[model samples]
Target: MPWAHAGYADADALAWFAHCEQVRADGSGHEFGIFDAASGTLVGGCGLNQFNTVNGFYNLGYWVRESWQRRGAASAAVQALSRFAFDELRLGRVEIVVAEDNAPSLAVAERAGALRECLARNRLKLNGRFANAFVLSLVPGAPNTIGGPLSPNTALT
Candidate 1:
């Protein structure tokens, strides 16, 4: 995942958790681990990372494990996060920026009802290289079933 820290060690992951705690404490963002409901196994993680308070929007991010790929876990995680951002945080929009060559992620965004807003050039720097990306967005009050109208309490497990 280009969006994620490359070659993250255990300490790096721990530091990330601490950062997430600080972000929550400072009211900057929210991050959560995605787990399988039935077995309670960690499948991935999803979060509202970058907050654009001026625009009332957030940058959404998620990644599923290789074993969980092709399943609906990514989509579900995104939907739950989107619901959290829109309903709980009361944010205006959630954006998913994906590399153009990443077909699976693009599909996930599309399946989550994100509208492709535009193509941004050299928008992402991954592994010391710049890459183009498609900016997909989901706005509140949009007529979409990606994140079904579940009660706030039911969105995340």
Candidate 2:
């Protein structure tokens, strides 16, 4: 809900999928759909993007449907995606940036063991406006506070 608006259409979805595939093919990033394990419903999405390969890091982002809020969907996606970013891609850092006022996402970052690094100015462009954001990082070799490191194939609840 936070990342999307009400006017999304079928054409928009098609373009989005094409973009995701292109990103994967080009090695720029990987995006994944978060599905509910029990019923196979899409609950959210998470991805590792904005790669800084030279620095061994990627920017991680996620969003959950309003109906699925507080149900562990985003947390599970974060852990899974971070695992992939670190283990499969051999990246050293995963950065999660959240708008200063986005409490739910901020909580998800904290709950997933990301260390708060700083508050960055004009860090994000939300709905045509710039806003401050909290920068957090999840690094390998640190203790995972939520679920342990999960495989990318693992089903999210």
Maximum-lDDT candidate: 2
Q: Write the per-residue lDDT of candidate 2 for residues 1-157, one digit (tens) a residue.
A: 4337788888988898899999999888898888876678888778889988688688999988888888777888888888788779988788999999999899989988888999999999988899999999988887743347553433643
User: Which of the numbered candidates is closest to the native, going by highest TM-score?
Assistant: 2
- On a 0 to 100 scale, what is the lDDT of residue 153 in model 2? 35
Query: Could you tell me the lDDT of residue 60 within candidate 2?
Result: 94
lDDT of 2 at 56: 66
* Candidate 1 per-residue lDDT over residues 34-142, each given as its tens digit: 7776677887888888888788788898888888787787788788888788779878788999988889999999988989989999988877999999999988788
Local error of candidate 2 at residue 143 (angstroms):
3.7
Lowest summed lDDT across 10 adjacent residues in model 2 is found at 145-154
TM-score of each: 0.87, 0.89
Q: How many steric overlaps does candidate 2 have?
A: 0
lDDT value for model 1: 0.81
Clashing pairs in 2: none
